[model samples]
Target: MMQLLIVDDEQIEREGMKFILQKSFPSLEVLEARNGKMAIEIAKTIKPDLILMDIKMPGISGLEALERIMEFSTDIKFIMVTAYDTFDYMRKAIKLGASDYLLKPSKAADIVETVGKVLKEIVVDKRSRAASKRQETVIQKTRSIIEADLVTQLLFEHVHEVNVDLLIDMLEIDRNHEVFVMNVLVPDSSDHPYPLIKEKVSELGNCLVGALSGNQLPIIVFRDKNVSFRFQATSFAKKIITVKQHHEALGWFIGIGNVYSELNQVKKSYQESLVAAMEYLSPAKYRFYAEIEIVEEDFFDLRLTTLKKDIVDQIKLGQWEAIRTEVLSLVQFFEQQGASLVYSQQRILEVLWVVSRVLNDLGIEAKSPLFAFQTIDYRQLRMETGQLLDLLKQKHIHYYQQLEADNVQQIKQYIQAHSHEEISLETLSVEMGLSPIYISKLFKEKMGINYIDFLTECRIEKAKKLMQDPRRSIKEIAIEVGYHEPNYFSKVFKKMVHVSPKEYQNAIHGK
Candidate 1:
């Protein structure tokens, strides 16, 4: 079982986390610290695998506490929880190397999923460590046991079935609190969470929850009953925002559910949060329950006129590099605005639509290399707005690279297959069914060599190989590599190789 520690100033938050974490992963051992002093003390003794902690406290803030904990023991991974969305705090946390950031009132689902992913990574790291050891049998046996436990946890509800006290004892919880559930979802697999999720949640109180998996995370926020649910939810949203800014790669979309009166119905809230998130799918990035309708106007200021002009300008000039850069830049801008996944998807679709229209106007086939990507249905992909934007960027870059590779391969194959012919840019263009002018420019840009120089080099190299054999005459070899004039071939060869054919033959034969 993986050991986790929770540190927070509030007793309720600490106890609440323990309940949820215990419920999620019944076999876990949890430890709780009410302040920086107690957290440091626990770290010295418990040495838990993961720590979820708050950034702000009375005496030693979560940030300071994190520093001290790291000083005491560097191995304990931490996730920092903050009620506010302060870039300074995020920058500090990132600089300090906190594993993740979380907002207050994070759901149980989000917590579980995040923790599950971190633990999975930990298990992988442990296995790697064991593999490096000399005792192969013992390592294999230990791995098997752990793997079995993990598989069971994934497949069965045994984690939930375990009694709270037993689970707390297993997890080593030092506090008592109620459990709540948080669920988070995104387009891509978050099976491995950012390591910081554990540390952040631990600080909130106690994350008695299951493992983190994919984009969906279940959290259990432990706060006093007097605390406003909205306040906690707002805090949670801020923390997620901080996470997005720091780990921009995660591309997370967040949602919150109505709080449950008891822990038993916590899963219901998790489900509700999903519905809430799904409702505002069109924004490029989004936080659920932040607004009821997710006013589309907030994220996008769509100007069809400008977007069309940019696409046309890029395509007409063959400015693929600029097009890619601009598209990615737009995505980043929208992500910063907190657009929903649906919003980003729609935005990409709009861009594709405009691009396709431009291609159509130019009499370019919609399915041509320039517009081929539009053929695929992006709706099949289940991802949030930020993630969808990322995919768009990836696809465009990959498409450009693949096109470049194909072009290079075509040029190489054309040269090789027609090596024995009188090959010039014009001749090669005719053979390859391309325009002579376009082929010449493409060869220069793509291969960084001109037609005449490349052909001459090819012909001369063949002549040298033939000369090396001491069988073929220079005249014959010149013809074989498409050189009609032996004298000219000899001169070209001499210029490139700095040796006469006879002298080259003599040197090869040791004459």
Candidate 2:
């Protein structure tokens, strides 16, 4: 029961989008705007949850209109649509907080996905707002809800332009005292999320506890000047175990973050605790953060996070050389980090997982029997991690080569089937889910010649075969080989075969 608005200068586009949305979402109320002016007016009245808009309008261009509209309401999500693929428009739209964008002639699936993603974000925002309102209602109970929300926010680093001092005060964290973060994830299939958590928070003395999203409950512990951090952290870890043993229904997975001297570093503690907690899900019920092979210094490299994305994109483009280069770069990075053999093995394992994930999305399975990744070899894993990952890429290259081979075959089949019809790179690209450049390059790489030359060769060859019957007219044969003009076909035929179509037909007919 949500509203969506479609804004484009073209009447046809606006109407088309409206129909598409209505078909996809039966309950949604779809509104249309013919121009930016109409779109701005509709926003003033309706303030729709999402918008599908074009960039180049007659006056007050789509980008300008979006910028003006955002001045009043920053919440509305916009998916910018344009026929042009200019980076400038994309950059400007992003700066204006566009939810996403669609190119001209976008499919129904793309439209639905872009809209669905924005709608999901809106729902999450609404939930966070509701959670905040609930916390606001009960200020007296500082230890439970409000404190938990703030701590959770800190751990998630959800604080963007937030009033840090006010947040610090609300959590009641001391600057001088050493702080630690411990979180427990319990598996509960029941309707209730955390029965024992709420019941046990009251018993913990001077602890700042909070409930994170999903089934996580984070406990913030403080060590005063008199108490040692080791003693306090050890006691907290044992307490979580004790809590689970007593309340047997809630099978607990506990993670205790490292100790820190300042409240600002609670996020570090949260990260450590989160890693431990994640490890515990498949590992042990209780683990200390230090046991994790990876350190914070290793986590700060933005390159590592974005490297997987690069791999996915290059793989999608069928750029095997680029993927190989990136895989080596990743492995080399781990080698330079000089982390433990376990870390290097784990790192390569993660790389394999990313590659498999990308391949799986494309309906391609990456089966690695040698490196099952279920177990690891200590010595071979560290020194030969790069070569191991490099070797595994044969499957990826093989998949792409097969795909390209199949694609070339498909193009050939399509040309053969549609000998009489017009065929262009644009049409073939649409069919193959590849760009024109890629299609062109693949044709030469596979067939050892240009696409146009191959097409002409195919047409002339078919024309020669048809000329055997002698019952079909010259014009008919020309039309059958995708040529509108007989003279043009003759010119092309003579250039390639050293004989005109008429001469060839007459010679074969023994004229």
Candidate 3:
């Protein structure tokens, strides 16, 4: 129970006030002292939360005791109770730390009202403190859990367009502003106290930092334009060093990546810094990863670079089969090289994004579930990377198959509609938004014949049917079938049908 002390020289006044207080507030554990000296001694043990002191007291004045007691417990509330309601006395008591006052011949209602007001203040103060604690907890979890997981998923795939407001709202970051990634690699995770370091970093304004939940503890820093990535990374490294030495948690390293302006590039920066820190993770020092050194290789197969170029060229040519094969080969190369799961996941996703950009260039939107990036689940499929590749290949197959069929339909429809308009593959190329070579190649693959061959077949078939119409001359019929001269039309007719136009006309007449 909360303790309240009543200090008075008169036994009757102390007992009377105690009775009224007890009746008004039964929750208070009321204690009494006859004089200021006794009040001080009793408070030393009971540590009363509120005091009712008389101005005139035996042994020592209430003001003197209050001054001394405040030196020990300034938070304790003091209420001066005196028979003299002089303004001078009131001023002196107020100066000596009295929170409130009561006049002589105090009624029960007045005493109850004064104590009740102090109790009410205590309740209000307690509520405020509780609210502050809850708010802090909410902020902590928001940055540590929700924000961290969302960030992780995004890094894995081109997940939906990132919610920029996520950082601004949860982390207090200005997503429009510049940001960079700082990695703190503590091999001995148990030794370094990251939460404390994160708390201190948060105290500094104009930055958002979060400790991800995983074996590798990465700290993402969203900073104002004034703070450079190098400076922030180095400063944070020093801070970690200080914390380590202070707490005797000594082995750790920090890696810093280049600063970026766009929020979408955060994952790129994160991967760069992560690779740097992971390279020399254990030396208890910091490294600026802005310039990751590339050592010379013994066997550099130029085909790897050639393969990437070849696949992109194929994308431009609209060869889905070739593009899909090259993409799979890239993954196979990464697997054969024994690249780390994280490294492979990052690189393959990048390669796929480059491939997806092909669709965007051709005014095609990528809507496959596999293309979502988040669905890849790199963390879960670290061992079964082949499954991810297979899923991606399937999506590519379905998307391109439908697209190729559409292309075939358009090409055939346009040909039938303008067969006599002197049509060529180049004209169809512009009409279908595809390269001439790709259109020809796809035409044969889908229609089972070369484009010109199909055109020749359609023309000859139309001419034979036109031969049944005796109302038109041979030259007019040639012009109608896209040939400018009757001789050329007769030559094509003889070559295709084994009979000249007049011979066929005579044969029809004889029949």
Best by TM-score: 2
Candidate 3 lDDT over residue span 135-154, tens digit each: 55754563455455546544
lDDT of 2 by residue, 262-356 (tens): 77788888766755664542445677878777633555346546776587677777676665566566556666766554555545554554565
lDDT of 1 by residue, 371-438 (tens): 11222223332223234334444545555557657876787777766777866776767667778887
Off by over 4 Å in 1: 1-186, 190-302, 305-398, 430-435, 445-448
Query: Worst 10-residue stretch by lDDT in candidate 1?
Result: 367-376
Q: Candidate 2: lDDT of 455?
A: 83
Order the candidates by TM-score, highest first — what do you get? Answer: 2, 3, 1
Instruction: Tally clashing residue pairs in candidate 1.
Output: 83
Q: What's the candidate order when arranged by decreasing lDDT?
A: 2, 3, 1
TM-score of 1: 0.33
Estimate the lDDT of model 2. 0.70
Model 3, 503: alpha-carbon shift in Å?
A: 6.0
lDDT of 3: 0.65
User: Model 1 residue 426 lDDT?
Assistant: 67
C-alpha lDDT score of every prediction, in listed order: 0.60, 0.70, 0.65
After superposing candidate 2, which stretches have Cα over 4 Å from the reference? Answer: 1-290, 293-303, 306-339, 347-379, 417-436, 461-471, 484-511
